[model samples]
Target: NTFFQISDLEKKLEVEKEKTAEVSGDDDQEDKVSMVTLSGQEMSFESRGELEKAIKEMTSVVSKAVAAKEFRKADDTQKDVDALIKLREKLPSVFELEKQLKVMKQDMDKAIKAKKFALAEELHDDVEKLEMRLKTERALQPPPPKDLAGRDTHSVKSVPVVATVASAASVRSAATTPAKQPVLPKQPLEVSGPSSDKTVKHLRPSRPLSATEDESILSITQMLATKRGNAALLVGPTGGLAGILTDTDVTRRVVAKDIDPATTSVNEVMTPNPTCVTMGDSALDALSTMVE
Candidate 1:
């Protein structure tokens, strides 16, 4: 009986050794393959099958582009890749907002169960505010127009402009300023509340102007007055959103400097790289952006 038990124990030890050997082999094979990233760092793909698949796809595409001598095709692919990366980066903010909203709702429910009506009301209001923000976040920006076959689409990236918090007086000035003589084009302004449809983009009251930066401040002032808008979207020579000229800008920067509006250029006084919300953002998001 003792000899039989010893044989069984030896057999079990041999099986354990085989399993460890197999695992080590897998580790050795995983360490053999690595990828050099754009940041000049070496990344191992031992367990990332998706990354390996993406690399294979990229390699195949490069070979095809080289064979066809179609460099523009490669450029277009790069643009698509960049867009995907940007979209991926944006998704986390929405998810985080949703998580917070869920927590708020849970707290509100607890308050109601405990007969704390006032606390429940406050939590409910907070939840509604976060919900609006989440709606705005979910609104995706309209994709850029597709590039022409052989032409790379160059996009204009807005530079961060220096902005100051507007005081109560500045806000009042903006509220009172009217676009002067000729009426400017007006965009739709939709303000949604708890009772209305929540899917609509909260378009704030503003006007888009194609006037050059060298445009007279007087003309901009009149345009704002004419359109009943306190702010004008200044367009660059390239027809892109160059800057925002507002009543606050005029009051603090131009009027305070004692510069004649007729002689001064709008570009010289306008706030460059103004904060803006996309079409899908809610009214709360717009308000938060302006406040920030």
Candidate 2:
């Protein structure tokens, strides 16, 4: 009977030991899995490093696409860059969590070396919890701002260049229309000229030219010289007057500012939303508006 009782006690102890070992093994496995998972997902939140690399790669691709005249691919790549920017903005900063994790790991190592098994185990659990928390924060960060392209918008520091280009093209088309089409009035009326007494409509219309907002100031100046005109009308998408680029504008806004007209755009110096007079208005009235 005594031997049987001793055998039963030994069997119970063995079973308990196996259970403890199984739990410890499971914890160890979980820790390994957590670390592996975090590393795999590092690219998603390690944005500063990853984003720079991605932008550089994509910029090269964009340049190539543009060179190939594959505009669609270039535009698509720009959208991808915008998306990456949003993703970066949406992720919480991991700097603090990372610092805590590093310190905790160091402490855990020290505890183990000092034979403080209980403290080490506790620290290990804390580290796992911290890792889980870090993951959650990254995954559940607030949505990116409404204006994802705000940075790009700010960089250009003006109206939409594409729309401005289209408007400019329309002005060019109007300028080059056939003789049968109703001609637009000449710009920068010469008040001292013989035609000054005539109403705007009675004055003979000439081949009025235009310049795009994006056109370099030097190029537009050359165009004016080539056409022997003092001014070019800046038209909008609807063919309505958006602004005017004149020799005076170049002299004042460009030359006075010491701006590099070769690198500067007409848009930067042209008078925006210029005042206008009706066809019935006398040349004097038009000149007065110009003076104002």
Candidate 3:
């Protein structure tokens, strides 16, 4: 005639408490003493201040996330806090829990009124996240809060250091090592192009940008403009410097053969290494080479 057996209901209630403990309790939390029933079953809830600390933690994460330019995370956090508040609204005494939501509300409002829309958005998102957490806390149970004074039982004490004994050794080495002799400075090389004003405007390529070894031939034409019987070789990766295919060379070879430069590479035209100077070579040596 009874709706359900009392002994059977007690056993079911005990099983529910165990399940809630596993979900909400970490290793550090104490076991629940009182079997308070909420949502038609027995499970413990955190004390007011401890509960507030958790909400603050969620909000703090929201703030840091917003600072890091991670908006998607901020959105998820907003969802959690929103759920908490909606559950808090359903509680009977509500008490400090409702006040916590109000403070969060005010903080959000101030941010919005100041037109600090980004900050406001983060705070608003944080409140919504707190609401969600509370909804979860109500559905499942949260661990019981610590003592009112929140005493830390862990002791602070100095760790003793063990001493290490070392064996003494006798010194037998001589005073010092001798100093090394100074080295003579290496001489600088001299590179001569021209002393006169003929090739002044022309730009010459000393080295190639890439490994192609092609020489840029611009300034040399302008530089050689005033010279009468002066013609010099443009040496590069191809061949002899003076072994050039100039207008004179082209007219004689390609034009006479009815061929085109587009069909030929600069290797078919430019002169290779004519003469090069070493670092020890003098200006007088340079003049003699030029004359040669």
Candidate 4:
């Protein structure tokens, strides 16, 4: 029985070889392929195997590009890799690095033009992004003269004209400005108990949300049900009301999407501070700001 099986395998190999020989030089013949399609509702990739393969391949591509000093290509491949990593809610650290590099480039351009060599030195020193070696090489090479510098032998204005304000407004102008006062009246603004025929307009955008207030979804929902409020006051890292969130925005970002509570980071949802407020505003001033 074993011998018969071996004989059959030999026969199969011979037949396959004959078929390959017969099909030789057939360029028009379509190559065999297997394709798999996926639904967004299902796994983003067709399977875990496919996803892993793609991740490893992208990483290898980027690594090779980096080794070869092809930094621009490496940066691009890094972006594609970062996008894939984000599908798992992982950080896109490389993307941030790319942004920093871009900002440094802009700063370098401005610094060179303005002759702010100190700033350019700072940017170059602080820039710890990929393609650093290549960029460093290019940076060491001096820039060409400006168009005007390269122009006619006889020039009307050989010397450049640059001017700057000697000084800003006087220190007294800032010192004499009055501080912001609180919005609370000498007496509390009265509201009818329980039953109200009319609603108070709370349109001022400066309302300070309390620090003691909970940051739960229940807290937010309850506020929306009772108040004609458009936004929630987000507390800052310093443990004070930081910024605000709005209902229309809530309807768009969270409530409508039903995003996973565990996976979704609210920091992205929360507003950042130094939020468009009048500087030196007091708590009462901030509240009165809302009432006004």
CA RMSD of each candidate after superposition: 24.6, 24.5, 34.5, 23.2
Scanning candidate 1 in windows of ten residues, the lowest lDDT window is 154-163
Give each model's whole-structure lDDT.
0.55, 0.60, 0.41, 0.46
TM-score of each: 0.32, 0.31, 0.19, 0.25
TM-score of 4: 0.25
Tens digits of per-residue lDDT for model 4, 14-63: 99998887777352232222222221222244222244345557667766
Candidate 3 wrongly placed segments (more than 4 Å)? 1-44, 90-292
Residue 130 local lDDT, model 3: 65
lDDT of 3 by residue, 145-253 (tens): 2321132221111111101111110111111212321111111111112222222113332331221213223333333443421433544222222233244434533
Write the residue-wise lDDT of candidate 2 on 222-281 in tens digits: 888888988987654334444578877777567866889898656555665555554544
Model 3: lDDT equals 0.41
How many clashes would you count in candidate 2? Answer: 0
Q: Which wins on lDDT, candidate 1 or candidate 4?
A: 1
Lowest lDDT block of 10, candidate 4: 158-167
Could you give candidate 1's per-residue lDDT for residues 203-237 as a string of tens digits?
54443554666578999889877767767777654
lDDT of 2 at 115: 100
The lowest-lDDT stretch of 10 consecutive residues in candidate 2 is 31-40
